[model samples]
Target: MASHLYGNYFSTRSQRVLFTLEELEYPYEWHSKDFARGEHKALPYVSEHHPFGKVPAFQDDHVKLFESRAICRYLVARKPGHLTPPFAGTSSASLVQGARFEQAASVEQSYFEPPLEKLGFELIFKK
Candidate 1:
């Protein structure tokens, strides 16, 4: 079965997942959630997709997931050698490359996204 993404166009989080899907050339269906009407906050979206009523909830044949980054990770892992370094091999160089990739991802999540989100909220959403 094809994957399904429940998200809003206005959500950057949703865009992230969408971008990942496109970059990986993954076949999927998009379900646009109406944030203006609070569709994300209502059932059965809240119960089935995201507990916090967030955008970019994902479902595949094998699993269901929320959070854009996690969904992106899963997608990338599904089709390796495209967005990620080849760490499947047991070589030391490959291990180091994988560690570096994880470090960079952690830095972006921990150090970059928070401030950038705040800045976007202040500069764009607040205005």
Candidate 2:
């Protein structure tokens, strides 16, 4: 029920949410809000869903959520299966793993963003 996806297959953030949803076994409505075509900049739905013009945002029950980690945590709490720990009754090791996951996720973001930005310009813009 949250906002739908709006990015291509190669979008790491988008893929992360999709895989989380899949692991959670939650059905969702999916959309591709392609930034390469400037839809995130010009589309009305883009503004309606995400004022900041970012992808992987979600809408549900009139409440909106943003960011990939937030979305993943949301799904994990709402439809937790085996992909993540429980919402409030998590144990210490689970909490530690959660922290570790977050650390790795942050590192993944830090590691990939610049190269992807360069590749984006090179592959999509430098023509």
Model 1 agreement with the true structure over 1-127: per-residue lDDT tens digits: 9999999888999999999999999999999999889999999999999999889899999699999999999999898866975576879988888889899989999999999999999999998
Best by TM-score: 1
Query: How do all models score by TM-score?
Result: 0.91, 0.66
Compose the digit string of candidate 2's lDDT tens values, residues 1-127: 4445555566667888888877777777787776678776675765577677777777666767778778888887776567655334478877888788778778867997779878988988677
Query: What is the TM-score (0 to 1) of candidate 2?
Result: 0.66
What total of clashing residue pairs does each candidate reach?
0, 4
Each model's lDDT: 0.92, 0.72
Residue 59, candidate 2: alpha-carbon lDDT = 67
Candidate 2 structure lDDT: 0.72
